[model samples]
Target: MLALPTLSSNGITLKPLTLSNATDLAEACQDGELWKINETSVPEPDKVMDYINTAASMPDRQAFVVIDDLTGKAIGSTSFHDILPFVKRLEIGYTWYAKSYWRTHVNTTCKLMLLTYIFETLEYQTVGWRTNIGNHRSQQAIERLGAKKDGVIRGNRVCRNGVISDTVMYSLIKSEWLPVKLELTKKLNDAH
Candidate 1:
């Protein structure tokens, strides 16, 4: 199992998600009742512990709670799952933030931090992302990060609502990281 490290930058922090974070995460989900969104993996307040446990139990996943440093509150969650150390690759998924944080610099900063750690620190070759086909906003966000759409998998998995959904795939190889990193840094700077 890979050890997850705490990452912080630009007033945001990504800490390893744990059972102790359950209360904060539950409150974060309540911001927009995120659990109601079928396409997302956000859990209901009552299920927060189960969610954290499941995430922690995954041998191939490293989950993090997105925290707003200014307030020391959990704002959302994201993970590096589907790890393939042999191939030096992983997919970033199971990400969601409070509605108020949307359209802000939070996502960009988080992506920059994760990308830097994966590509530079960890020396990973490629990073991938997968989202529900119906999640247009997520698709746009992933694209905005410079990930190229690879394709979609039909009936990839059943969603929380029991609907079988297509999964949209995207990836960014190491060769593409420099430009993407520059762009992400620019976006963060411009947001200030």
Candidate 2:
């Protein structure tokens, strides 16, 4: 099993998600009733435990709760899923934040942290992202992080609303990391 260490920077932290995070996760999800969204994997308030348990049992996934450093609150969640250590690759998905955090520096900071850790510390060669094809916001966010659109997967998976959705794929290989990292860093620095 892969162990995820707590990572923090730029006023946010990503800590390994645990069953104990049920309350925080529920509260975060309630911010915009995120579970009502058909495309995301966010669990309803009553399903938080099941969500965490499932995440814990998944050998290929390491989930993290996004915490706001100054407020010490769990504001969102993201994960390193579809791990393939043999190929030094993984996908970053199952991510969502309270609606309030949208359009802020949080997403960019988290991406920078995760990408740096994967490319530099873990020496992972590729990081990929997948989103519901209808989720334009998510696609934009992933693209802004410098991931190239790989293509689409038809009938990828059943969404929360029980609809089979097409998945839009994106990726960033190691060779593309340095410039992306620099751009992300510059964005974060320029934000202040």
Candidate 3:
């Protein structure tokens, strides 16, 4: 992956993930249930820092700190993983938010900002999404973004329970980005 850049729009900002955000990210992750459907968890602040560091070191990934535009505080994290610039494709995964931000405009805004950059700025052709097959909330949100369900695959090994789990895959190709982007823009406005 190329050097990641800070992205801002729809009252949200995505800055490169950094260790300085560990404290806030840890605090935001107080709800252990947040990890129930995620492949990883941070049960402690130090672990959160470790997570941030590990994400930063991924050669094919670019993680970002989701900052609340109003409070200007780190509220969550998201990333573009499995970047294949040669193929013009990437996966949007490893996203999580504070329990307080759930069902709010935070995720929608961040997705819009990130997707816009990927499809328009970065010129990626396909943005993929994947989550535990049992993670209904995540699957639903991805669908809401007009990402089409591609298929399911087993052996996604990073499951929270330490068991290899089935992964539900979805994709938003460039052809679908226009309508999805429009709908997401409308959602952000309606949310306000």
Candidate 4:
């Protein structure tokens, strides 16, 4: 059976990706600043529909559209992918925020909600995060989440742009989550 895909907290909501979401998905991908840090280009409408269809059909990929509760608009995307049931592990990836929402409460709320769902709801023992080594912004965000820096995987994978990037890895184990989550929550709640 498939795990039901919906998670919400405070005013943030995460819902499963759908073909109807292509327009917002494309808009989220418009900012070149975000694209520079990501490995894949934000797809065109037709391409986004393909992404939605393919992702929804994938048994292991639990993709969600990050929606702002107040405005009810799609602002970004995130997913629990590379899930390994036997090992009780999952990877939080393919995350991108609309440029306007960057460094806002929205981002923090989203991360906190996702972590809560992953470690508490899904009972995942470990959650992994990785980014292209050249993407310092992403590296900083991962570290800020209290994820321990694991070694980088050299020539880890090729980007959609056809360039190979060494991926810097980070992870948080369940044993380490409570305190870390507490700290992150505090930081996210505090005035920035």
Please give, for residues 57-114, the per-residue lDDT of candidate 4 as tens digits: 8778788888878888777788788889889898888788787877777766777888
Candidate 3: worst-modelled 10 consecutive residues by lDDT: 37-46
| Model 3 lDDT tens row, 61-147 | 888899887887888899889999999999988898888888888888888888888898889999999988777988898998899
Minimal lDDT window, size 10, model 2 = 1-10
TM per model?
0.98, 0.98, 0.92, 0.89
Model 4 misplaced stretches (Cα beyond 4 Å):
31-33, 36-41, 44-46
Candidate 4's clash total is 0
Cα error of candidate 1 at position 119, Å: 0.1
Candidate 1 residue lDDT tens string, 28-83: 99998999999999999999999999998988998999999999999999999999
lDDT of 3: 0.83
lDDT of 1: 0.94
Task: Extract clashing residue pairs from model 2.
Answer: none
lDDT leaderboard ranking: 1, 2, 3, 4
Who wins the TM-score comparison?
1
RMSD of 1: 0.6
Estimate, for each residue in 126-146, the C-alpha lDDT of model 2 and write its tens digit. 999999999999999999999
| lDDT (C-alpha, whole model) for all candidates | 0.94, 0.93, 0.83, 0.78
Write down the RMSD of candidate 4 (Cα, Å).
Answer: 2.2
RMSD of 3: 1.7
Backbone clashes, each candidate = 0, 0, 0, 0
Error of 1 at 36 (Å): 0.5
